[model samples]
Target: MYSICRRIIFLETVAGVPGMVAAMTRHLHSLRRMRRDYGWIHTLLEEAENERMHLLTALHLKRPGPFFRACVILGQGIFVNFFILSYLISPRFCHRFVGYLEEEAVITYTKCLNQIDRGYLPMWAKMDAPDIARTYWQLKPDAKMRDVILAIRADEAHHRLVNHTLASINPEQKNPYKPGE
Candidate 1:
């Protein structure tokens, strides 16, 4: 469980970078071209915030030391620069990469759920959802960590589909996803 928490903490911290980078890149492009964004920025911003929320939820389970924090800082800095350059060079590739990333996130959370159900992760099996998770996911007051995992898996699935769709579309085309679809 400690290992899993550490992995998730780092993963979530890094996962939160791409969306903000893509959104900002597109925003600047829109301004430079004097064109409308067609709702992509909103969704991208929401994705970034959702990933941040996931990081916050996982943080409730573990308190990282100085080394871990430094690693996250370095990882985030590297990822942010890489993603920004990649988004500028090829938005489609960046979006597809993020789609794959979210697919792995879904898979990871699904595996975690399986472990909890099978009693392989005893601590998580008995744990309650963090308050941040409960609020972010609108889970019931009695929600457990299992419930939190379920919500996270769902969110990841949504992001996976959204990014794949975005990758397939023309950059100037209007985003197909509405606010909450």
Candidate 2:
């Protein structure tokens, strides 16, 4: 169970780092094409990508020991929760060019959230099996990691709500280019 969680965390960290970089790159490209003055937004996007890359590298270097695995899971939970909150509280922070590229930005955000919901979270839940949960409970009695894990789960659920809302608002639209289409 620990090894499974570690592998999932590693994959998720790697996948997420590149995904964030790509999203930021696309957003910047769109902004540049629009001749927008988005210096601050660009800086923020770069910072986000850098942070994700740093975390990914850290996870990559660390062996799948109990402590390292726990930290990776806890950190991922925090990161995902932070991302969801940031999006909900200020979507413009990430989607500043949405006015000029509404369809593309929305499609990208929806696809990203779908990946988290349909892929990452399910894998996370499965990795967190009974024995793993027991080990986690016994090893980390302070419950900080568990709390963060639950919060991440809730954040993922909230993402689903957001996705459903967006889909309802734009029912006719289709993301035909999405993977596994």
Candidate 3:
């Protein structure tokens, strides 16, 4: 249980990066070019926020040690710079990369859910969703960890779809999905 939570916490930290970098890049480009970003910024910002929520939710389950924290700081530093440079070079490639990562997130969360259901993660199988998870996902007050995992998986699927869709279109094109969609 701790292992899975730790992995998820770390992954979410990294996963939140692209959206922020992409959004900021687009915003700056728009301002420089004297045009709007169509509707991508809102969605990208939302994606970043959602991933932050996921990280917060996982942290509620398990706090990392100092060594793990150091690793996160270093990893985030490297990933943020990599994403900034990558997005500047090719936004489409960055979005596609994020889509691929989201696919892995879905798979990891599914595996965690399966482990819980199979009685391997007994602690999580019996635990209730954290209040933050319940509020963010709008889950039942009595929702369990399984319920939270399901919500996260659904979110990951949505992000995968959105990123792939974004990758297929031109950066200046109007975003097909509306803000908060």
What overall lDDT, based on C-alpha atoms, would model 3 receive against the true structure? 0.92
lDDT of 1 at 88: 84
lDDT of 2 by residue, 1-181 (tens): 3443454355445334322543455465556677542233333344344334333432432346678667767776776666555554554453332222333333433443455456644543333323333342243434333333443344333333333333343222332222211
Which regions of candidate 1 fall more than 4 Å away from where they truly are?
A: none
TM-score of each: 0.97, 0.32, 0.98
Off by over 4 Å in 2: 35-62, 65-142, 158-181
State the lDDT of candidate 3 residue by residue for 1-181, as single tens digits. 6778789999998989988998999999999999999999999999999999999999989899999999999999999999999999999999999999999999999999899988999998889999999999999999998999999999999999999999999887999988778
Q: Candidate 1, residues 82-170: lDDT per residue as tens digits?
A: 88988889999999999999999998999899999999998887899999988888999999999998998899999999999999999
lDDT for 180 in candidate 2 is 15
Per-residue lDDT, model 3, residue 126, is 82
Compute the lDDT of residue 6 as modeled in candidate 1: 94
Query: Where's the lowest-lDDT run of ten residues in candidate 2?
Result: 172-181
